[model samples]
Target: MTKEIWLNLPVKDVEASKAFFTAIGFTPKPDQSAPGERACFQAGKSIIMLFPDATLKQFNGGLGVNDTSTTSQMMISFDAETKEEIDELADKVKKAGGNVFSEPSEVQGWMYGFAFADLDGHRWNGLYMDFSKMK
Candidate 1:
């Protein structure tokens, strides 16, 4: 049973990446390598590590890590407590320089959410589920 998770991502500019996420309510964590080359940000309790291209290249067996600015490798999600929260996050995503590709809306009658992409074009979503609507 895993208790924690960490997502490591590559960024073209660490400072810019940090500012973008922090603008959207994420907090920076102190424990990270290389001040200008790496950063650690927290989304709820999960840790997301941002590393420069040079550092990330050393980790992926020394080759080929595609940039999400062109193609997506994954879409990370966040859990929202209510429908309003989902909508709020969607706004923040755009205001923080991310794109809200899918506006917040009801889905399958029980879930409400929106999809967006970060400055680097990494996709993400914030979803709210109503258990009462489950069959």
Candidate 2:
């Protein structure tokens, strides 16, 4: 059985990426990170690992990594506790130099959230779902 999962992402700068995530409320794991080579952060119960492009290429069998700025292979979504939390994160993302591509708004009358592209152009969606409104 899988007890733990880690999301590995490629970044241009490990320290910069670490700073960006930290600014947006992600808890950095210094003990698990290698300075200038890799960074680890805790996002809720998931572990997010950021590695430089060269390092990630080696991990992915030397395949070319997609240019997230132009093409997206996937979008990671996070569940927020409330609409206010989504809004707060959106603001923090903007302040941290991330692009808020999607403004906070209602979705399907039950979920509210916004999307943003991190410093590495990785797209992330923060959503708050109202279970009470579910059919």
Candidate 3:
């Protein structure tokens, strides 16, 4: 069985990606830092592997990169403990040079959430579930 999971993503600039993730509260692992290859960032138990554009191309057998400006392959979601935490994370995302893709809003009157795009144009969703109302 696998003990850990990793999300591999393509990035234009490794340094900038590292900085952006760091500013948004992720810690990069020094061991994964390498030249023209990859950088690993940890978000709680999740590991995000950021690969250079060229390296990622090679890893994908030279497939053309996706147009992240208009489309996304996935949306990484983070669960917040409270609505306040969701708001705070949105602020943090903006402070880290990211843009809020969607404003915080209620979901079916059962949850609150917001979406943001990282410096590399990856979409992330921050959500807070109202468990009290679920009962």
Clashing pairs in 3: none
lDDT of each: 0.84, 0.94, 0.85
Higher-scoring candidate on TM-score, 1 or 3 = 1
| Cα lDDT of model 3 by residue, 33-128, tens digit | 885567898876789999987788888899977778988999998788889888888888898899997988898788899999888898999899
For candidate 1, the TM-score is 0.90
List the candidate numbers ranked by TM-score, top first. Answer: 2, 1, 3
Candidate 2 residues lying further than 4 Å off, grouped into runs, are none
Model 2, span 36-101: residue lDDT tens:
999999998899999999999999998988898679999999899988999999999999999999
**TM-score of every model?**
0.90, 0.97, 0.88
Indicate the residue-level lDDT of 57 in model 1. 88
**Winning candidate number (lDDT):** 2
Write down the lDDT that model 1 would get. Answer: 0.84
Scored by TM-score, the top model is 2
Worst 10 residues of 1 by lDDT: 30-39
